[model samples]
Target chain A: MRRLKALIKKEFHQIVRDPSSVMIAFILPLILLFLFGYGVSLDANRIDIGIVMQDNSPQVQSLIRAFENTSFLNAQVERDRREIEKQLVAGKLRGMVVIPTDFTRRLINPDDTAKLQVIADGSEPNTANFVQNYIRQTWVNWLLQSGLSEAMLTVDERVSIQPRFWFNPELESSHFLLSGSIAIIMTLIGTLLTSLVISREWERGTMEAMMATPVNIIEIILGKLIPYFVLGMSSMVICTIISIVVFGVPFRGSFITLAAVSAIFLITALQQGLLISTVAKNQFLASQMAFISGFLPAFILSGFVFEIKSMPAFVQAITYIVPAKYFVSCLQTLFLAGDIYSVIIPNVIGIMILGSVLFIVITRKTRKRLI
Target chain B: MLNRIKNLVIKEFLAIWRDKKSRVILIVPPMLQLFIFSFAATLEVKNVPIAVFNRDTGRESWELVQRFEGSPYFTDIHYIYSDKAVKEYINSQKALMVIQINDDFSSRINSGQQAEIQLILDGRKTNVSQILAGYVNGIIDRYNRDIKPEAQVRRSSQNAIRKGKLTASPFLSPASRSEIVPRNWFNENLDYIWFTVPGIVGILTMLISLIITSLSVAREREFGTFDQLLVSPLESTEILIGKTVPAFIIGMLEGTFFIIAGIVFFNLPHEGSFLHLYFGMSVFLLAIIGIGLLISSVSKTQQQAILGAFAFMTPTIILSGYATPIENMPLWLQEFTVINPLKHFLIIIKGVLLKNVPFDVVLEHTIPIAVFAVISLSVSTRMFKQRLE
Candidate 1:
């Protein structure tokens, strides 16, 4: 126990002594979290749209006004259909809303049908589809309310669409992105930093020298780890502060809950790195492996780029092994929903399960190397 | 000078083959990156589940619901009963959008008035919100089409009108049908995966290979086989060639494997010339390898070199029109992208694979990459010296 304490002290010394490590430990996570919170938004706002209204009626004008006012659309007029297509090809317009001639007279007439044509560039299918739908819905709403629809003249029907946004009320992109950023930064730094340290020692022959000492193997290992553990905590704190204070990401959940989950996740991540480093013992190879197993999984499989709920059954099943998956859920609850006990309980359990397994495997891997 | 470079190139190849680790370095990085990044780098949001509140229960609303169900974009459609149910869906994030039907939906349609369906999006994940709104609009349009007789009359009139100009061509209205036929050139469905997979494969493979090569060579120098190389009578050109070619071949092999996989697995049909692709690829490969060699030369050790490579790669990825469009970048940042070989290479690949345009059309993009290759190669080779100083 005394040897283990001394080893941990050595690890702390190594971390405090290196200025670059200290700066990275204190600053990088915070910066990364802010970038993720602010810059990495999937929800496109103020989208550029092209409009060429042929109808000059009050009905058409009001419909056009509705589109221009919508937050999603940044409406612009193209001189002609050719110009609209050109702008779309150049990526200036996400889509085009064309109001045809006699749009008002046709809707008011018993037999005349009112139409709004949507021309979307299928190049970016996601954004194009969204623009088409939003403008069309607005037009439909205008047509309905203006007493232009033949059906409303005959029927007493009306729908009250009460819109309520869950988890995010104000719909800030920061809440979603900040949480995901914590998972990514933790995976990248946690797995990557630990791997390089152990790999460097092995490459420089320090591992063999350390093994020859009278000190216990666990003591040396603990010494190597204590500094990184503190560094990881500092990084998590930096990330949380940057996301909450700098980028205006909400922290509705308790900080203690966030820290508890982060501790387990960091332990698992660092152990994962240590296991790979002990096996590879080459910086390039170790870094490559770390990129593949740690960063890539965190970036992709942890519900970052694509929604895991939308993935195929087999792919969703594969996500169970990646600890970032659980962490991302935990972060969202903390930042957006503010500490839902039911939501967090399972995620905490999942993280602990991963941490315990990884810890056992790494300890065994380190012990074998010592023996 | 040509003969000397050739001899050096041969010596470089021989030395790389002599070291087993060098072979591992060549083969592993690119393959690993390709496998990992293919799964990682996706922008397409698949399988959106939507909750539909059908208040009308009329033929128009049914037809509108049919359109949503028919679209492959929507995975599952649940019948939502109350506004509270919509709220629950949003909170759980089980549904991105709740298409709420107004109580007077059928009556409004019957009276030739408009009906509204409110799209209550989770908005927690903003990227998909706009897309869901689009789908709702499309369904409403279909709803309008089924119920409105005026829509049918306008369609017949549009048959007479062309480009907002009404021409008196009653004699030869036969050509009107062809205007309706838009046979898409390369991708008929325009799958997002088809557009992204090839470019991503090139970038991810290049990132891993270049990064590993730069750091590995610097590691050797940091650990001291560099002194042995200086004493071993290997010329500077030979040393540079030896360091670069192995990784270059590995990067190319990895790229080629992904190209094949894209065609076979992702259902991306290729329309461009194989020879043209190979030509563009070789030039781009030479450029990136040159940059990696330069990074290795300037860096103090493996660690510093790796960090430096990361700094370079991050900006390259950001500016390469991967995550965001480069044209949207500020003027100076856009100008800065002119020097990045990856940007040119991506345009070439996207042109061939997605647009299926003629090679000459994209020659403007290809030439700059070749130029970057020449510049990087010349600089790295000139800077190469036997000693660390």
Candidate 2:
């Protein structure tokens, strides 16, 4: 135990002394999170829309009122559809809406149907698609309200859609993002620090030096991991505070639940790094294995991108191997929703189960091979 | 002098090329990185999961739920029991969006008044949720339109009986992204993957070749073979040459794999001449390989070599526009990126590959790659002799 303590202290000193660990574990994650939070937004707001209203009637004004209602767009009148296209080059707007002259008259008559012309900036298909859809909805609502038959049933009118969202009341992206960053940062530090520790020792022949000492292989592995495990935990806490306190994301889950789940994830991450370092026995290969196995898996397979439910069956099957998946679920539940027992229990147990199996694998890798 | 230089270069190349694992290491991972990055570099949100809450417990509610479930825009799995359940689902982030129908929904629609259904979307992923909310609003607006005329002329008297809070009055038409709006909130139509992949390609090249370069001298020293090279009449410049060629080749070869992958897999385009890209990449690789050589000169052991390289990598990568846009970075960081070859190379790659921009525009960045190469290469060789002393 005394030898292990010395070794653990050495590991912590090495981690603190090496300026690189400080940068990767703490600095890089924060910068990445802040950058992603501010810049990589999927939500479109304050959009400039070019509009042509051929008919300037009160009815058309009401239809235009719908455009004013959605915070997403404020329409600027262009001379014609051609001018709207011209403005796309001038960088004036992403899309243009055209209200046909017959729009107000059509809703007044029983059978007359009105057409709205939407010219979307084809460059960004997603946002443009949404923009055009919004104008169509506004037009439809106007027609429904202006004394048409309740069952007038135009071809475009019959099969209508009403959407209601649940859970995320306001749909704040920061809440989920802040939660997920905790897992990514922890995974990064856990795998990266351990791989560096063992692999550096192997590269420097220090592993041989330690093995020549009375310390057992178990002692060596545990000693190396203990410091990093603490650092990883601290980094996770730092990130949680940033996301919750600094970023103002709400925390909803129980602290015990978070502690339990996070413990399992960190253990699994550290061990996987150690196990890779054992096989690689070299710094370059160790880091490569850790990154290819740890970081990539966390980014892709972890419920971070492309929902597991939506992925192909085979991909979903493969994601079970990624520890970050369960962590993300737990993190989201904890940060966004106060007590999600229904989701938390299974995820926590799953993490523990995965963590146990990984620990076993790490032990087997260390069982015979001290050098 | 030239013959002596040629001999040293040939011998160093032979040493690097002969090791099977090392040769495979230099060649294979780049190819793999190219393959992985092509598939994984997309920023566009593909599939979003939403929660569905149905309270009416009747046919109308069921049909409404089916529409949401069937819609491709939403992955409607795992239904919640009540309004509170939907709120819980959103709070837990188990559902990104919720579509709920009030108890009087169907009855109100039948009686010639429309019911306002509530859609609470989980907004954790701001851009994706916003895009998704637009999709939901579009579909729901259509649903409202279907029952329009029933309340219009014929059922005006029936419409008068509509409830206050949940009722959709004739005057209140909720506007959804059923309109035309501006595009490109971040990177105007340059397809976000086009921006991301080039940066990833730069990182992949840096990661593989830099690792090899950093370890080459240290590996020789660790194995006690570096003394032989030291005793040979080869000047430090010649020795540096011996080290650099293979590293440059390894980096270039990796870029080739990504180029091929881009063409075949992503249908990535090239706007500029292939020659310019080749030239730019060669210089960029030279600078980065020079950086690896500089580390090799100082690092006394393999562990030092690896750690030295890594200590540089995180900042190098962050400064590059892989995880974040460079424009958003602080001015100091932006200036720091000027020296990072990956940063210039990323711009060059994107300009040529994605935007199909002309060579002149790309030249702004290519100049930096060349300058960095010459500077680092000169400094490393000068430092090489100091190390020998």
lDDT string for model 2 (A1-371, tens) is: 99999999888888777766776677767875774455343344546787787888887787677777766677787446676655553334766777877766754543444556666653344455556666655555654565332333332333334543333556555567667767777887778778877877887788889889999887988898888888877777788777777778888677877887888889888888888788887766676677777876686667664355545456667678788888887887677655668777787778788778888887776776743
What Cα-based lDDT does every candidate model obtain? 0.68, 0.67
List where candidate 2 sits over 4 angstroms from the true fold: A10-172, A368-371, B1-51, B57-63, B75-80, B83-94, B123-128, B150-202, B214-232, B266-272, B290-355, B364-389
Models 1 onward score TM values of: 0.78, 0.75
Top-scoring candidate (TM-score): 1
- Residue A362 accuracy (lDDT) in model 2: 79
lDDT per residue as tens, model 1, B173-287: 1122111112222444646676567767778667756874677578768778777777766667666766676667767777788788788877766667777777888888888
The residue ranges of model 1 lying beyond 4 angstroms of the native Cα positions read A12-39, A43-123, A127-162, A169-175, B1-41, B46-120, B140-185, B324-340, B358-361, B367-389
